[model samples]
Target: MLAPVDDVVAWGESLDHLLECKTGQLVFENFLRTEYSEENLLFWLASEDYKKITSESEMKAVAKRIYAEFVEVDAPRQINIDCVTRGEISKNLSQPGPNCFDRAQRLIYGLMENDCYPRFLKSDIYQALLEQQ
Candidate 1:
């Protein structure tokens, strides 16, 4: 279903390229949705947004929101991460900062790149898009 011409180009290039392009990222997000793994992309996007927050109050607010939604145990969209990383995030949450989620963010990024991205490339949706091109 990801038929945007510009995005199609990057989709066929590589996962790294696709992740870097907004259009391609959306397509990938949709693909992840079909697999019930949209949280991976959502976590990555939230991290990017978190880095852009300049206000202290805003940064703490977004940090807590992201942690509660994606990093905390039993979180609605909790991402799979090691206990150490999760523990670090939990400790940081007590004094939430702009960089509190950095470790967890990196772990999620790697999970997507190494796990989901490969499956996405081989998915029927991706193949269909290639055929269309």
Candidate 2:
């Protein structure tokens, strides 16, 4: 992971742009890891995956797993979300749909877009990469 990344410049375009690019996601993910707040990105990623399930049964199973791993109270990698958002996700658990995590996902997206992403652009890691590129 230490290799100098190409196309680093494109990542600064926007959060969506960064998330969409494979290399951008890695760079951003590594940046988040250093801040010890990788959970937000991880949750956001799980939400994306949850949205792609084709079957209702499969989607429900993945939803519960996503909740257990990320949304539930005391989840091992519990994301920083408000009780209302958390409660909404909890309410949808039993008959969860693909969009069950939508609210929490949007909230986390806002957190990353407004907070973490800015710092990432300013981080030594990103700066050094820019210098390399």
**Which candidate number would show the highest lDDT if scored against the true structure?**
2
In candidate 2, where is summed lDDT lowest over 10 consecutive residues? Answer: 1-10
Error of 2 at 67 (Å): 0.5
Q: What is the C-alpha lDDT profile of model 2 across 9-30, one tens digit per residue? A: 7677789978987777888888
Off by over 4 Å in 2: 1-6
Encode model 1's per-residue lDDT on 94-132: one tens digit a residue. 677778888888898889888999898898877788778
- Sequence-dependent TM-score of model 2: 0.92
- Residue 87, candidate 1: Cα error in Å is 1.3
Candidate 2 Cα deviation (angstroms), residue 79: 0.6
Error of 2 at 38 (Å): 0.4
Off by over 4 Å in 1: 1-6
- lDDT score at residue 83, model 1, on the 0-100 scale: 92
